[model samples]
Target: MEQLAEKSKKREFVKHPGLGETGIFHTKADGDPLPDSQLLTFALAGNQNCGKTTLFNQLTGSNQRVGNFPGVTVDRKDGVIKGHANTLVTDLPGIYSMSPYSNEELVTRQFLLQDKPKGIINIVDATNIERNLYLTIQLMELNIPMVLALNMMDEVRENGGSIHINEMENRLGIPVVPIAASKNEGIQELVDHAIHVAKNQERPGRMDFCDPDHDNGAVHRCLHAIIHLIEDHAKRAQIPLRFAASKVAEGDEEILKALNLNQNELELLGHIIQQMEDERGLDHGAAIADMRFKFIKEICDATVVKPKESKEYARSVAIDNVLTGKYTAIPAFVGIMSLVFWLTFGVIGTWLADGLDLGITWLSELVDLGLTAYGINPVVHSLIIDGIFAGVGSVLSFLPIIVTLFFFLSILEDSGYMARVAFVMDKLLRKIGLSGRSIVPMLIGFGCSVPGVMASRTLPSERDRKMTILLTPFMSCSAKLPIYALFTAAFFPRYGALVMIGLYFTGIVTGVVFALLLKGTMFKGEPVPFVMELPNYRMPGFKNVWQLLWDKAKDFITRAFTVIFVATIIIWFLQYFDPRLNAVSDSQDSLLALVSGIIAPIFVPLGFGDWRISTALITGFMAKESVVSTLTVLLGGSTASLSTMFTPFSAIVFLVFTLLYTPCVAAIASVRRELGGKWAVGVAVMQCVIAWVVALFVNLLGIMMGWV
Candidate 1:
């Protein structure tokens, strides 16, 4: 261990001629330093919901960052493996193939081809090994060193199935590790094997899943001819010969372009592909899929033992009978979400938040007394007590609600109920010009809109991607939880959970209404059909649930200290000064009030016309959480004073506006990157217009019903 540490230290220090003793070397274009030789990188690839992310989180723990692949909005998660010094693991976006049919597949393929990671960790779902191995064959053709992690082996074993791991490893010519990632079982073994494979420069010995020269059909003949034709070119391009050959046979335009094939070569390739299609009675793509699956079946037949009846599978079926039923699915989904909300807002979360608020109040008073005794300047006291503490502390007090909500959401995701929700919503989502796949991003939006908007990249169609991005903000992310908690606590404490559910329902309804309007006019197109695998349900691990809760708490606290802290200072400065930079005795005479007053009258019809309310809304564009913090600062952190600003009807209207209005600047930036600048601007304008009109109608309705 000491020798390895010494070697790592030596590798970390690289001598540059112009910069002596420098520990890092920067690339000229991006100035990002490359990892040293001692730092090995392994790509983790697998199908969606195949325990891949669970394995990744176990391997990397908290040492991960969410980034983007070059020129793509898809998430690129990279992390340093636990207990494996100088080894980095990248969790590729979940994909079922390497065919570039979708952005995720393309990104994963391009990263492997371009970045050339040292090894690949192909995690397969053990319970459904046959289907998952289709991707395994494709990854093997990459010719990189790889380890097959047969994940969820515990579940498979529990259900009376068994895999001969050693036999499977021998057949596949790669290391196979049986693991239950959720249980943190066999993770260390998996990581150790992965490191050994990477360091030894081990490559898969059995790359040909289907014999190219065999006289299976014309498809075999065509693949053989293409491999021979492209062997030299593939070698020169540093691509795996068999992989390039298969892609060429399948008529992948990207691979053809990358190969820089001549015109005559292209024509020859096309003739071969067409000949195979004509003779075999199958298209090139279909023929390739058929051959791959046939190979997978042979391997599975030899090494896997399946029970006629699987208890887990039977249970899942029983649950899905009702959960995915035509009549019960939607209602079940609503009931499930309502239960989540009740737990978060009405019971556990509300109690925790109340305790936190009281603690913060006590701390603030103690600090105030100390400041007063110390004879601190009044201006400084006001800035610390009212500006920073009032603003940031108000947001922080709702951390329990955010954490609790995400905890339950994580449980739903881990237990596989969320996947069923997507399946159930497919029919309804299709009517809005989106596939059920868009629900994944929408559900993520309920946690945070930035990632929600980015998640839209998973949609295969460009129109669906843009439409999903535009509508995701209407899902009401956790950042707005503080706003809801504050208002409900002050005005509607008795119905906190119901009001919270209503806000979410309002957001969904608003999004659906706009989706219909947009589909009928601007972005008219039929959504592509959704296809996804639903993993068998399992009990969510307590450790995994606790980690997710910690992550939410950490993120919320980090934002409070950073974005919210800086924003609070800026807002305080604006409210504390006049145009001439003179101190203002009255905030209404200050710069913030002056600026907000310009837009205050516009919200009069929606019921929130106060300059302070307008100011809070404006700050909300910076971050939705800022709405609560800004209001807290303006109202002097008194719930009683804040409560007087609105009656129940106006509060409902305000909540409706908040729910449907434009997302934060960060989300808009994500939209701009995913869609375009014009679309981003259009979404902001359209959401504001929609929000205003909807709020006005809600207020008028309330008046007519005599609720005000």
Candidate 2:
């Protein structure tokens, strides 16, 4: 270890891909010239599936949350390095090119242009350099000081391809590093180089833009001329005016409108393009892209080498077949989901919660004993032990259940099966006017609506983002999980798993159907094209999995103690201070009871009109998990013995209401913020009405048929 440290100290290595040296980084011995207090931001940019996200996690660690850009649904992630202080990393949405054809690309471009981070860490999958380099070339054009981290080198070596790092570096005038992010190789060096570059220890040169010879081509002249014209007209735009001019010369419709060029100017530009095409005998866009590829190919050819056979390559191919192939993949996908849910809510979750509930019960008893021994006021003691502790802590004690669920989800994500699920389900989702990728945000919604709605930021289109946010609340969140678990355990002991699965699917199917109807009218738009990168899978790392589990558990615990704690206090006030309840009224004569009773009639068609359930649904707006807490408070005891608490009809009605209800206030605020006031109001109203009708219909049908 000492020798390795010493070796790292002496060598001043830049990232070199060909020699299997991406960078020479200092793993230890910090507090040098670079101030420990300064935050270093690394922006990871690459084409879709270039292993950029994988590498980002490997470098900074996976203590992150999925979020959306303000006013947009694009996923925005920011994380601090666990081992390295003063280093912050952001995983930008993947983009095919920095051409801004989609929201992800635009978000990435906007961040790069405006945020101006310390340095850009551009990851390129070594195996597919040709396709990946298109984005790399665009990044070079951005003029951001960058370090090229070439990832997935193992795949390249197996595919009869070799790249010379030194030669490519000499050619592109930027440092290049080769790494296998999945295997956790060369990560230290990557970070060290990042620190060095960020600190100005070494500087990257300006990219040399090549003026390829297109001898006397009229299209080339006209394109250049039109570019100059735009530059002359919009001097104040300060917008990659050159790139804008190039797109206009190629007749990009979006760009044309964005720049607001009228028909006469557009016609003149088109005529110029035609003239250039006649002379060059090539399409302008095609010609430009082809030239970029040629440059990348030449660089790769000079430096890297391929091997005939490699175990990693063979394994990647075999796994891809089983995980993504049509016939077996679909069943595998369903089985995986079933197993995860079953484990989370049935076996692992229930057992953990039961154990914790026992502890809470014991703790409450201990508190009560102390209160009784001291001759404390009975009312004060009851409020402290039962209402506060039992009410709040009991609901909060489910942290183990929530954490275990997120652990499994994080493992699946790390293994890359999540992408395959989307790939497999795309066709089915399209039938319902949704995309398979929509599952991610909805699945997240199950945990918490805030992050779930925030996860919609990864969607590439505005319409899709809006639809996802609007419908995600339909999924029974973790808070609703307890309600279902309580009722299922109570009424359908033998078929608890099956009943829970039905509720989940009800939420899913309703969301899909709602999406179809929604798109057919308001927020009408065609299903955007689906393109996602499925990264190479790896054995799940125990450390990464543990970190993810703890992170998720920590979030639940924090909210329970803070948000839910405060919410419980407010609820206590509402129930206790009701005019009727304060006036020595019977339990049924409370002001809240009367208020709920007024709304109860509206739900009578659904068969469960006790007003208690109505109150639970209304409280769900604060946070879904609060639903279970509210129910526990109203029921006045442990949910462990729910068999006597609710009838089968009431359980079914409860599950339906839980599944279809509107999202929490936080989620609604996010939607209103992202989609604006008009659409936000529409979404909230639509969700409430749909949830009421669906719950009512389910309840009525069960009563009419005597099934409940």
Candidate 3:
């Protein structure tokens, strides 16, 4: 062990990728040193739902949404450590391994290899140590400074399991700190160890997990021969020999391309791997994985005391019997969502929103009286009372409803039920050329389509990502809640919750139908296999639920003030003024109505032919909330006025249009970023066309059934 430590000490790889071997890192990619080099960055990594994000929140005190399901952190997020501005921690997307099979794993691998962080803070689920350590084994090959955070230690101890931290640390040639991330236990020590190793450039002492005496030395001999053969190529590619060699042995095409190996060298390497696989009685990838697991088993045998299954698992199994049962899962999902909508629209949220609306209306009337008494300019009074208050305040009242819905969703997420939803959805998603993994993004879409679009990046298949992005806009985002709230209150007050649930279900069904069509035409292939961990269910933590609620509230409030605010102001100005800049008492003769009149004819067949309604729907592209605020201002801030704009049948058609129409600009931008401009344009055009056709179909059907 001492001799291996000496060897590791002698080898000094670059702290930052594509930089000098010196421990000092520079600020710029050009490798020029700067004072900013003092900033030390570490990577927070772990398998999904292993409490990696809980530790990130503890370390940085930043609330980056932490859900028990995978793909929550689909992209990298960096934060400064609490009380340590000089140290930064980047929470990487959850990944199972370094293999570039999935997009998240590939992104993590590229980041580690190309934009190397100084150290890795590898958090592992101590209760499920064997599976978590598989990733840890791969990370050790990077040869960077790392500290193993044995997370969920409290759970392990409660379940009668224990780990010999010092022994495991010594065996793995890295520091191991026991921690309960959720409880913020042992985090300081983990931070101190990470900072110390990074500053001191402490690489892993052991690079050789395979013992030469094992398997009659077949695996050992093959690894050493390939390492020697590719030593120069690995160095030329600026990759650690250990990692490059392992990837080469596993036939990773990306690593092979990076190594730029010549034909002869490749052939020789293949022959050595083939010989090893023959002797080991396995394929190359299996042989390598078997060897690594064998090493992990030995280490666990020596240092880990396996625990009895905990009550959490027992409860999860009991819950799964109903939640994920073949015949019951879908019905349970529908019932749960129905209940959430009922509470949000029919009872709690609606009551709170009504109270808020009354308060706002009182305030608005008071302002109106003050302006009239003071003889304020009519235009200025309208901007403040009708524009800002009527517009922004109208959407603001829905905040409680949005937050309440997210609250229930977050509980489902933190309790680990979301993972079961994905598992149960795999079969259905596959039929539409998607996997259960696509459900994460789709679920996120219900909150907002931007992150939902971004979450598609976690999908490995391009076909699935594109289809998921296309379908997300149909998943009735919370932004459209105001539209539903407005119409339901004006048209279907007693059936608000039922109507809301029906709208959401309709959006989902419409998306599924389109997805099936796209599968057969645009993306003709099956979805990739869906493999994910089902975390043991536990009570939702207050912190996680609060953080999610706060995030939703903050995002909604910001957009209401920013995008929706500007949009409402512009809409009010256009509605009240003619093209010659003259204020008009009648909005129908105003500039906004005249312009929207051009599009009004197109929707005449769908039943909403009014220019004011057309203008509101058009403004919704800027912000979906704008549809509510614009309509409120244009209709003179009275919900009762909405009744005269459309009959009940026409209102349902309008709701259907809004539910299936293109998402706001932010979501489209996300799609453009992911799939490029053409796909973004296609998605927008496709959604609008589908929405019109569906609305028209509903209108025609209602007439046929004598329900119009």
**Which candidate wins on lDDT?**
3
> Can you write out model 2's per-residue Cα lDDT over 132-180, one digit (the tens) per residue?
8778766765544567888877667656667777677666655677888
lDDT of 3: 0.87
Give candidate 1's whole-model lDDT: 0.81
lDDT of each residue in 348-368, candidate 1, tens digit only:
999999999899999999999
**How high a TM-score does candidate 3 get?**
0.94
How would you encode candidate 3's per-residue C-alpha lDDT over 474-552 as one tens digit per residue?
A: 8989899989998998889899999998899899899999988998999998888999989999889899999999999
TM-scores of the models, in the given order? 0.89, 0.84, 0.94
| Higher-scoring candidate on TM-score, 2 or 3 | 3
- Clashing pairs for model 3 are none
Clashing pairs in 1: none
Please give the distance, in angstroms, between residue 206's alpha carbon in candidate 2 and its true position after superposition: 6.3
Q: Give the range of the ten consecutive residues with the poorest summed lDDT in model 3.
A: 19-28
- Report the lDDT of model 1 for residue 401: 89
Q: Order of candidates by TM-score, top first?
A: 3, 1, 2
